[model samples]
Target: MAGKLNEKVLLTGRQVFWQDTLQRLFAKEGWDFYVLTKDFPAPEEVFRIHNVPVVLYVLDSQAEPKSWAPELNEILAMCREHGVRRFYLLESLEMPEARLELSEKIASAWRGGEMTVSFLRLPEVYGPGAAPEDGLAADWLEASQRGESRTGFMETEEKREFLYADDGAYAIFRTIARDFAGESLDIVTGQPVSAKELARTIGEVTGKPLSLSVSEASFGGRLPDSSLVRAEIGWSPRYSLKDGLAMAYEALQDEGESWQRSARRDRRINQLRGWKEKLVPYAENLAGALLMVIVAYFQGGTTVNPAVYFDLNFAYIGAMGILYGKGQSLIAMVFSSVILLGVLLRAGANAVALMYMPEHLLHFVAYLFVAVVTGYFADARAFERQSNEWHAEQARERYDFLRSLYDECVVVKDRLYRQIVNSDDSIGRLYRIIRSLDSVATENLFTQAAGVTTQVMGVEDIAVYVLSKDGYYLRQKVRKGRLAFQQPRSLRVEEHDYLKNLIAEKNVYVNRELVKDTPDLAAPILYQGEAIGVVELFGLDFNKWSLYHQNLFSITMRLISASMGRAYQYEAEAQDKRYYSGTRILREEAFREILQELMERRRLQGEMPLGILKVSREGRSCEELDSICGKVTRNEDFLGEHQGGIYILLPDADEKVCNMVMERLAREGVTAVREEKML
Candidate 1:
């Protein structure tokens, strides 16, 4: 019967007679069940573990001593939801005329479809572990033990049926085996016993006089007929009332003896626990004080100076502060001061009055001051430790936000570094051209530009020139390959459509005729909108090129133009670089005029406002900063050195722009602070 079963049952109560009887009868059988007690898991978890198809809910109904327990409706509701049929055990179906609150709800739910329940009514069951307060058999036994002559309760001649615990348990097993669903049956012994006759029978068993005194208020009901229950279960009681009473009295005698031994053990344990609680605290403090004195004795002890122990005393104060807080630290400090004074008096004082030895008086005052200050700080330290827990929670929320920003910056830096290193990109082409002009020693500007352009552009030839220093005629610096020029020897700024377009529109022509049959790439090399030189590539097939690649290469020419301008200016002048005159940045006098021009234009045109930035470097290297300024500032803006600092005039920039410039300068070994101002 117990080998393997697809279905299981839940027996939800801890009553000794009913559950123990069922557990022993169903042992090694297919009717597997679980008994829920106080230590069992929560009700929802119990449903998940057992998954029983049937529930025998005994706690909320007749098993509990109260008329109705809270779990009665709750356990029934859970069984109904899981489609588990409920088998309810009871003492009787006949309710008193007045019903309790829980009983009223039980009647309502039974009428509705919320509860599917069957009843199995039992009689007054007597067995081991039955309380002396419940049932007439135990009550009579308690009177005989106390040497009372009689017990007062119940009508003297009122008769009630009796059933042994084992007989009632076997009847329940037979009823389940018969599969009696939703049937109510009174499973009793059908043997009546009078209340007075049960008291005399208990006296005979216990060898003590016992009798019953009739009370006016009593339960005089008779047990219901059990003819149908006997037929349905095919079972009958195995024990008569006289035999059951004799066995029950023997069990009560054994239980009274066992309680005497357990009470003695509990009393001894309580006595030991009471002593430990009163003495353990005093023992710990005494141990700590003794250890402090031992440490002081081992240190250097000079002659007749009690304050030699001051340093060691302070160490104890700090340790006590962190352990038990400020109040205990002050107490430790006071105790040590008293100990020091007592030792000094016992040794022999150097002087008794402050007038004789003023140094000794100052040491005593210093000792008191140290204790007061240390105690104040210890209190603050404890408060800070408590407050720091709240601040740590706030900082935890911002940690994730800061980490995301740091991760985003790392990805951007890697992408930018890769673009500058690849050879096929525009930034790569510009890097190569700058390296070529920076490394060469040729004085002529176009000679170096032609060599680098040929390598980077893969062109047949390149020719370069710039306007003469007086700004009148074009002066040819160098030429390579056979690039014919159709312009006059001294080209005027107003002559030729290509030169007019280069001056007016700042255009770079590619794969189009410049003079006549020269259809390649040619650009106007302008430095900050002034013509510096020219670079032309020959034999380029424009029909085979993407518009994007041509435009990207056109952008590379502008970057090359700025580098060529610096090379042209350096070639023309060989004088020493002054602070402002020969350097790339402007002088103060030039900056003043540019500022005036920008302010007037902003007032008239209603354009975006301008910002002035003052950058301080604190006299670190200005050479690195000058080069960065030449690259960072627009041609329309002004950069000047003033008072060991740099000034930048941003015409269409705001405070945010000033901060961006400060960040870029910081990367070039310059620590700059920008104070932005609006015009």
Candidate 2:
């Protein structure tokens, strides 16, 4: 009966490859699926698609929230109008808050109504080529593999939840088929496993004894609980963690060859295109030259004029004519007239001066004709050379531009890959940045700005700060290093003097001694619109500033400022709902209490604050308090996982802490120690 239901599902947005896979998975489950490639489609066109009764919006978290909201509403309206009863909102695990809000909005639209709308939250899905450094699951797996037994606040004993790609697809299909009354379903494995356990399972599957050295600090956030999902859908995952790991590993092995083959194909295509472009002009010029030579031969009366040299003169004129074709008509005509005039003058002069000597007169005429012919050939050859040179110059310029673009792309790709591999919020931020920047014409302008500013300011660190409701935050569109800051709290832009000036004046600011003088400037810096936090260019040669460098810096500053403004607007609009929720969340003492407990746990495990803290000698004793220190290190675990905090790993237990803990540790004779934590 379920297989017979003539229902069609529509999936939309970027990452077409993933969407295509999902479509295939759906077909395997007996339902027809249609994918929409555009970011947003017209409501009428969407309605016109044949056989698609249900719309499954697999929206990218980084997509423009405002744009998607209206599109979603319109689709829902169309679904309602067409008597389509079901709508499902599927979200990935990166930005839970945004997903939660989207779910709530969808629920509100359908709740107590005839149509059925529900939200499904998927766990980190893994497949072949799955490494902790590539996908969300891979990020967690990588962390567990790297930090097995190290004591740090970021280190967690709690297990993570992961769903295989197929398992996740199956779960979604099952949820869509099931008749449920709820507004949300967690499409995940209901089992909870610790990081250590997951690592062991991966090691077992790979046959590699991955010795994990866990720092007491827990760097990554905890997985969301999916108990609610299991209860509502009456669905359970078929694959266990071990089974999923094995399948993922096998898939990666099979896909390795395919990935290599695709890369080689891409290289070959590029090479072929380059060769085609090089040969096109040469072919055109050669054909044009041959035609001109034939025409000149016929114009010379097809006679062997040894005395008059008419053939030579005609050849010169014809060659010159073709050469000048690429130029202005006026220029070609002027050169042609000059050649004809010179030939006629020489012919007439010899004909009159030595008329009695027929051989000498004939020789003069022949010489004039030969000179004309040679001149035309020389002109044609010169024009061809110039055309080729110009073509090569243009190609060189284009190649340079493309090379620079490729470098920028590589930088962005690497940054995105790192974020994906780490499963960090920066991934979400970067995705948003890319989406927002996609709408702009000057895509590479931001990167250029960062490079120029770094050189001009003579500062290793530069960051662009945009004014937000809660102060200023560094835009993470083009980050250079690991992101340690949260959206609002981690990257406080109000502290930096240069940033403050930039924001206030809406202009560029240059500070040479930023590090020593500006104590509040953040690292992995943002310059102009790019996130080039800190650049290490040592041994500065103070050469006289050239106009080129100056112009580059000036242009970069403008571009950065413009990009930052656009990014700021996009983020501001996207975060409005979150900003309100954040205010409420922050005001909730329960949330804070939970956060405090987690921070204490992190401290005990030795996880320091997100940013680097230069602990002064005056505060050195604060490291020695074991009881208070333990609470601090362990606080991270209690803080709901996502809240960033400090950790303290005691090296030999002699580290100082708060006044109370310092006195107690001193009395206990715990003098020297070592400790570590996850940031």
Candidate 3:
């Protein structure tokens, strides 16, 4: 359909449960929306169907990155090939660090390349098709309908932002309309709602009492700043949390009604089966008795010794006993006996005389013997048949239950297998990390460690310390965020013997003992099973301080350690290439690369200060100029020659420090100017 926006939008993902909502949202915004279903055609073929200018790849939170990342990369390549200008990645806020890592991996190749990729991070989304892990509103509504309590595996006090599916889709529409690109925008409400608050809201919406049981496990919430996106795109949620819950409750109510109708149909079928079982045996017994009565009436009603002549009746009794078991067969025997006595009375044989006669008594005894023996055996056979049927039913039920369990296990196995194969923290990610670190110089490993920790762990405050060769002290190499000013410059081994021993043993030392001045998390970078350096975190969210995060920290540190260890070995082999001959200053190319990385950090973090002092040679020799500048600059400074001028790169420096460095250089007969606007 042609609408306000002429460019078509293609929505695709690993799993697209909200396609309908998105379609509706796009329609309301007067844009053509085309959905690519499971049948993924060739990229060229897809373009033939709809020449779309924008592609929105919805990231499935339930799926492992490996399963979908390759496909996404292929699409990105296709977009670039076809001149698609705008591409959006819609992702969840759960495992934010993982999301960040995944986004980078997908967009790494296209950093400065074509086909701009933008990330739109969403909070927990709730709607009719929402899963339990994605949204709690649907779960609470269903529980309320069933009059049951839902168990939560997170702390009751933990609050998380929730967005409706329609609103989320609209956010995407707004981003496309506004042509937002080359930026990661978080689509959130900014206000986090707790479980208790949501539960109460659901109860109000459903008109049922809500009950929630919280466990010891805690969940971390990400408070993404969405103010910029809101201001830029002019978009906000149209529905409140309460209104969204009400709509979800209505959807659940419709589903419940459908389930009730199906249940009623099943109940009726079972009732018919019950009736067939009850009436079949009784009908057979009645027909057998009627046939026997008709035969006796025609054979001899007035004949003498009718009981003897009516011997066929005994056959009928045995057949009934075999067919209908003891109870029904006994009824048939009584009917036959009444018929025999009536015939004998009609033959003028007095009832008293007949009872006295030994022949008549023998007939009566014979009949009684036939009925009792057959009934007993028939009853036993019936019990055996019923026992077999009961066992079969039990076995069938057990088989169905086991089959269900097997299916569940298969699903879980496939999911776990994919995660192990392609997860952001899996072996593939580790390999990538090692490859990324392999290119870094050994002296810059600490800076790389801090950057990796921030991107992989989603924490800003980090510090890296290098162990001295004497093994008696640790000197801080780099510090980021507030940690730069919080911790000491150096730590003595003897002063923190407990922490030192733990680190030497290659174990992550958590601040569980509540040691004052200790970081929230600390781990050693091991080289050959010995501590070479330590990574410490001074600031961490209370919600994120869990065993899971601790384990993650440990694993990440080990990876960094491996990279550092490898870099150190390479550093020994490439010493001459890393620096100018006979000087501590780094080569120009090496210094520029490091500077570019620091500048990237400043752009991303928005706070790292960098100062560069440009010193003129004034017709002096290169070696003499280097010696004078090296003496005045600190060990942290980088001195490099660029365009026939010696430049000093001061990290973590302010305007005042840059001016001081300039003065020092001027006193050394080298006229230097502080480059206040360093890129």
Candidate 4:
């Protein structure tokens, strides 16, 4: 059953490797693409939301049919119920009869409905992004890069065709773009390569020995015929075998380099430990021996009986034993005994005669006893400390590894969320942009204008300026993206009369006249044929400088203008209720609603910078507080009164800007602290 297709595409599968590449291609071709993963809560809800005319069900041959078949059938039936009449079942030719079983199942599931199912049987797909277990080529490449021999890993004498990931994605993209359906097509390269040939080619590309043994006489099932796909969809592989292998090899090299860097860091740490263990104790022993000799020299002949003075010698020996282990302590004991004998000689006592003295003998025995006892305990303590350190190191390493994994998971989840929710070319993005400006508060509208302009126009360097009260200047209220360098904070209308007049006439100004410091595109945020503000696009890709993008910029500015006009009208009708009687500061209730709206916008926009500063009254009257703060705040800044405090909302502001605002308030004798939890 052939039917007209919509601009939406729903891609669902067990493991879809080409989803990202295909998403980019679809976005470029003006299609709203959505992915329904196995973990998604409700398939029926997605089907209803997208209302796509086509569904792409990719079948992973490696997965057991029993695991995915029932779910696939249920989804197919749901798609039929949701007005999806076209389906393309992307499968691999390596699977034997699995394609037939799946196709038959889909047919049975949609028996009473007008369903058109097409099968695109692909060859072995491999590229840089392919997982190691994806195919034989990827597996072999992984083993070779890991310095592993694949000599007998899988002794198959078969020649199989392989398709690069991008090429396969392009084939499917063309099929969908051309609306080709209801037919089985084999998508592959014309020539098939044997395992030996593939192994050698990968070896050459990666500069590593594959060490694989492939049988000379290769045999395999019939290769897929790609001529039909080529003729119908005008698709062909853009990468040759060598070129594809090279790309994969380069990617593997990048990963290998990172691993090598980590390995080298570990080696350096181990070397430092080796030096500490082997050399540090001997250095300590030498320094301790020298200190003992110095003490012996200073104690010269102070005691009439040198043997009695030798009591201090016992203390030195015991201290050395406790500090160093048994071996080094014994060496230090020998040095101390020598120094004591020299001191005795200097005091006119014979060494042999002193040995015969009972006190002297007792003192010598005490020295040996102290050294042995203290050294043994010291050794035990050292061993215990080392064991504790080892356990702590292990625990620390485990904690660090777990933290790294958590951080990686967070990054991957954020990336996927961005792709699905905030993709640049989806209709949902446009809808979100429009909805962000739907607030009737003019302050809220101005707060959201910069972000919405950047997101919709796909430009990084943008500046928003509002027309000053007397129309003397367009003062810069908000700047988004990379305008970090110094730019003028104010633009005098007389300096740029051309731009001012054009914007007054409700026309967008492109930088075709070569005005210095002028943005690439500037449009008026018009309210009743008068310019209230201007949105300037300072930078964008060259491809966006054409008539189409200029027209788009013009239209986006008009949308913002209309929203601002409506907000102004609403403000006039309920000014006193929304704000305090004399100031631009909002009341408590209106402030709460605005906070909720801004937070929702932040969440949807991937956590755009939103800073809230809380200014406490500190026993001052509301009138006095407002009078002081109003002079320091910008027109774009949102000031709200709540609970005897003033909360200021600064949109698209980071720490630097927040600090500047705090400083200004400090100069005015007002205390303010950033409310981090409010965001």
Best by TM-score: 4
Candidate 1 per-residue lDDT, tens place, 1-679, comes to 2455544667774355546767667664567767766442556446644666666655333343353455666666666544564455444422342332345446336533434466666656776666754455666677787787554555556676767777876777776666666546778777776767666677777788785565665544547776777777778889887777778777777777778778888888888888776555345435555655665455433222255534565665556655555566666666666555544654576435433676755655555555566666877877897789778877876887788888777756655554455344456666666575562122223445656666556554455555655554554444455442332224565554565566557677655433564436667778767765555565554542456646754665665676666754664463233235446555555456456655553533244447677766556445655667767665445666654457877765677877787677666655566544434
Candidate 3 ranges with C-alpha deviation above 4 Å: 1-8, 24-53, 62-64, 81-85, 111-114, 143-158, 177-182, 206-220, 225-227, 284-679
Q: Which pairs of residues clash in candidate 4, taking residues 3 or more apart in a chain or in different chains? A: none
| Weakest 10 consecutive residues of candidate 2 by summed lDDT | 634-643
Residue 111's lDDT in candidate 1: 36
lDDT of 4 at 281: 75
| Candidate maximizing lDDT | 4
User: Model 1 compared with the native: what TM-score?
Assistant: 0.38
- Of models 3 and 4, which has the larger TM-score? 4
Each prediction's TM-score against the native? 0.38, 0.37, 0.43, 0.46
lDDT of 3 by residue, 198-306 (tens): 7788888989979777776655478877687678788888889998888877887788789899999999999999988888777876777677667766775532236
Computed on alpha carbons, the lDDT of every model, listed in order, comes to: 0.59, 0.49, 0.76, 0.77
**lDDT: which is higher, 1 or 3?**
3
Residues 1-679 of candidate 2 have per-residue lDDT tens digits of: 1345656777654352245457777887777787765423344455543536666776556565775677667667767655566777776655457655864576466544456777766656676545554454454444444444322234566555677776777667767777554666667576766656666676787676555554564434336566666676666778887887777666655676687899999999999999887665455445544544454455552223456655343443344444443332223333333343444454464534455776645644654454455556656788789999999999999999999999878866865564464331234533433343332222233343334454343433333332333444543322222122122223455676665554555433334564543422222224344443321222223441334434434544444555655655654565433222332111233334333433443333233332211111223232333233344332211111123322222211223443333344345553322223332
Residue 164 displacement (Å), model 2: 0.8
Can you give the lDDT of residue 603 in candidate 4?
46
- For candidate 4, the TM-score is 0.46
